[model samples]
Target: MLVRKMDSEVLVLATDNRGKIVELTDLLKPYHLRVLSTKDLLLPDPEETGSTFIANAKIKALTAAQASGIPAMADDSGFSVAALEAAPGIYSARWAGPQKDFNLAMQLVHYKMIISKSDDTQAWFTCALALAWPDGYCESVEGYVYGRVVWPPRGDNGFGYDSMFVPDGKNMETFGECNINRKKLISHRADAFSRLVNRCFKGRNFDGKRLLSFRQK
Candidate 1:
């Protein structure tokens, strides 16, 4: 059954990435959630020792929920290149080093691709979203968007590998070239968020602007 309305309830986002915070905040705006980030609460990020995206997301969410005594949401996302055997999958951020220099990371990808001499430029982005309650209950979902990699990473609109990725259906515009709203419409994160909303936020009534109430499922 669908849970009761979460009107004005607090939801802590278990991430410190400014880009992610902006995107997620925008996606969650309709729910009227009083969103806070781990940075805001002065909570230290838990070590993400999981092997997969979902596992990592769950770890972060559960850790934040436990620490804050409130519901928490987290997402672990990355870029994977088929030619590289999906390398840098879970270590996408690590590839950027401590400075979080994604430009260096993107350059590394291009360098690896060149040295490997792989004709295939196919790649994809993966995102896993997890929501956890203070009681230890948690749920997760994964989403993906496939496309090819582009060199000389174009545009500056997005953070991370957005410049190096051109999602399917987008004429040649890299994610960095597209605006946030346009990117949100078809991003891997958006896909995951949509699934989450369908599963958890289902039965909620929306009269265009405001959410009325949640219907019993």
Candidate 2:
């Protein structure tokens, strides 16, 4: 009896960010699972009280799973600058303010660096993903991609600080200069997704062994 799985694979994407939704939808499409965004379900956004990306991601994922009675996925991601001592780490989104005007945020970052007379433009983008089940089981993975800050922000391909970020080893192309496909190949989110796919999505198990093979590496 080749009993097939019905609508048992519906997963709620616990995010309202269209960029993340698009990226995740493409990444998860191969699984043939129904992925719904928070907007699609009209779910109230949860307040993030966590001090770290991983913690925030878990909070969102758990909230979605509990509220929707379905498996939920969420990611917390941001840019951290070495010169500014990671000032905008968890506050990346907040820095953009309610209007989500990243141009203002990028200017702030640039101003901080210039005022501090800091030459260390080194920075990195990090992403933490959490997958939660309705039964209260959850798994998480994090990833980072190093880069340098750029001024006179270029391109308009990506949203947020993309225009001001110059990723390493990519011909000095900022994320905004690269298309979605190019960005996916060298993004912190992609790194996190790779580990997540292996750790949890591979078996779709909440009790699976915690895989740290791709963390902070």
lDDT of 2 by residue, 1-217 (tens): 1111112468899999988998889887767677898899899999999989999999999999999998899999999999999879999999998999899999999999998898999999999999887777788889898999998999998887889899888388899888899888788999999888866555433433332322321
Models 1 onward score TM values of: 0.92, 0.89
Q: For each candidate, what is the lDDT? A: 0.89, 0.84
Task: Please name the candidate that would achieve the greatest lDDT relative to the true structure.
Answer: 1
Candidate 1 lDDT at 102 equals 97
Kindly list the per-residue Cα lDDT of model 1 for residues 1-217, writing each as its tens digit: 6543333267999999999999999998877678999999999999999999999999999999999998899999999998899988999999999999999999999999999899999999999999888878787889998999999999999999999999887378999999899889999999999988876666554433334434454
State how far residue 207 of model 1 sits from its true place (Å): 9.4
Candidate 2, residue 159: CA error in Å?
1.3
Query: Which residue pairs does candidate 1 place in steric collision?
Result: none
Highest TM-score scorer: 1
